[model samples]
Target: MDLQQMRYVVAVAETASFTRAAEACHVVQSALSHQVARLEKELGARLFERTSRRVRLTTAGEAFLPAARQALEAAERARAEVAAATGEIRGRLTVGSIPTVAAVDLPSVIRTYRRRYPQVRFSLRAGSSERLVEQVRDGALDAAFLGVQPGFLPQGVRDREIGQGRHVAVMAPDHPLAARHEVDLRLMAGEVFVDFADGSAARAQSDQAFAALGLRREVAFEVSGVELMLRMVRQALGIALLPGAFGAELHGLRCVPITDGPVRVERLVWSRFPPTPAAAAFLALLDV
Candidate 1:
């Protein structure tokens, strides 16, 4: 019935435990529980089924949650808008990015933004490009940086291509093809490979290239991050195909350009809906 009670409910629903939710909301467990109980009684619905082991939302709670989140967001947006009218920005800026982002230096950008709008808080989420785009569309993230295959655009969101790069073959110093200035994909077909998980956007860059040439390479090691892939290649376990920029600063690894490698297009994506004041400020910093 009240914003405080709704905040308690949303926190509990997200954390799934009164104790943890209270910790997140900076309150004691009993007082948070009292507020939630009072709201449930006023609404004549038991929102959560609480057992010793876990807390689960009931049907009524599931129905109530979306509206509760919207109400909280709206209240925050109103306050942020008022602050913006006074030449100040105040709100949370939630952003998502793929782990291999390189088009823009994220740390530098975040530092600059913080200096400009110290009142705004920030949250960064790392995920696959597909999942990050989905989060932006669903309003779970304010914006995202995605690296996907060329000619592909994330649907249902506003996107701008920021940079483009090609995949290269990365190998140990003594690798068979390491002496070559550039290697043809066909020549490297016989080498073992370490790559991103199968079916991921990063992995697809190599997979699609080999498929186009009627060549198949063995992916002996699958990894979630570029650092791991590089480490595997460094140990001479297998070579990997990654963005050319990724291998420049790595020690003890040689990056050979692939003659016919897949092109990666980096893009910035944001929600189609009107952005919050804080999100707008961040976008303006990026000139998006």
Candidate 2:
């Protein structure tokens, strides 16, 4: 019924332990449990099933969780909007991005935002473009930077294309194709490739490209991090196809232009609903 009770319930659901939840909320376990118990009594339904070992949400708790989160977010947004009216922004801004984001210097942008709005807090997460977009849609992230194959757009979110570029083949300096000015997909068909994990948006870009050409390259190394992929390429374990700008600063590796490579489009996506004041201010900072 009250915000504090909702907060306690959410914390308990997240931590799955009343003791941990109390610690997170900076309250004593007995007080937090009393508040939750009062809330459950008011609703006439048990919210959690507690045992000596662990705590788990009941069916009613699961049904109430989403609305509880939305209510909390709405209250926070209202407070932030009132603060914004007084020429101040005070709220948490959660942003997500792909590892290879290059359209804007994220650290620099965050630094500027912090200087302009010191009262605002920030959280950053990195993942594949598809996952980032999904997080944005789910309200876990206020905004996200994503990279998808050309001619495709993420659904259920508002997006803006920031930049686009072609994929380049990265290889060890001593590799035979390293000296080539540009390499065709067909020429790389026989080479072992180091690619992003399967089903990831980064990997899909190259996969769709190769499939379109009716070619298949052996992906001997599948990695989630760019540094790992680069390391594998540096050791001549395999070559990789990555965004052109992503390989520009690497050392001891050759980035060959892929003449018929997949095109990657970088986009900034946000929730379709009205954004919180902090999120709006950050988007305005980017002139979006």
Candidate 3:
């Protein structure tokens, strides 16, 4: 039976008088009697015994009372939970990002989000751009900040250009490149380069820059992560052309300006999903 019908049955059973039950339910006694009668007919069991002086429960009425109350309670609870999840905006939000953006930017944003919306929980995953995009497309993640490849992104996903960064030269502190305020394409024509691995957006830009200059330098090493690439550079294995912010932070590595033809901009990309209150608040805190 419907919730309204169940409520009427519960109220009538509690009061043991149709007049009192109608008063409690804000309805007339005759209307309440009509509804309870309909319920009894539908169930093929009489729920009440009405005498000239009093009303009492039947054997079936006692058994059905608790179940009806429980069903109404459960329905109300389900409605509340749905409202809390969709209407109030509180739940676990799974976010993914590329390794570089995760390391450099998301920590502060996450901290602000947690501080503002303590009720919500977060799950962070880090991977390459391809992997993060795939997770977002598959609905495994709510959103991600991933580097975009040169080709097409997946369908149904949206992109926002947050900010841009560029590649710079990373060399040892004692290297000759450190002596110059800025280095040019001609000087780096023959230096050993520690390259980023395949399938990386940074690597593609680096390759394009080197190709336009007609430079085919030696590859001293190939590494996947920015940290590892810096570590290799710190050992003086070879100099690397890395993201500008990455080179700027190294302790012993001298980051020189690349006075080349053009600097490749590192775009901070985000998902098209409307930001949750948590995500929106976090993005607002970042405005300062």
Best model number under lDDT: 2
* Tens digits of per-residue lDDT for model 1, 1-288: 889999999999999999999999999999999999999999999999999999989999999999999999999999999999999999999999987788999989999999999999999999989899899999999999998888777999999999989988889999889999999889989999998889888777778888999999899899887777878888999998877776666677898998898888899999999999999999999997
* Cα lDDT for residue 61, candidate 1: 99
* Estimated TM-score for each candidate: 0.95, 0.94, 0.61
In order of TM-score, best first, we have 1, 2, 3
The list of candidate 2 runs beyond 4 A from truth reads none
Give the per-residue lDDT digits (tens) of candidate 2, residues 1-288: 888899999999999999999999999999999999999999999999988898998999999999999899888888889999998899889999898987888999999999998999899999988888889988899999998888778999999999999999999999999999999999999999999889888888899999999998899989989989888888899999988888797788999999999999999999999888899999999898
Scored against the true structure, residue 200 in model 3 reaches a CA lDDT of 66
lDDT of each: 0.90, 0.92, 0.70
Per-model root-mean-square deviation over C-alphas: 1.4, 1.6, 17.0
Q: Any residue pairs clashing in model 1, and if so which?
A: none
Q: List the residue pairs that clash in candidate 2.
A: none
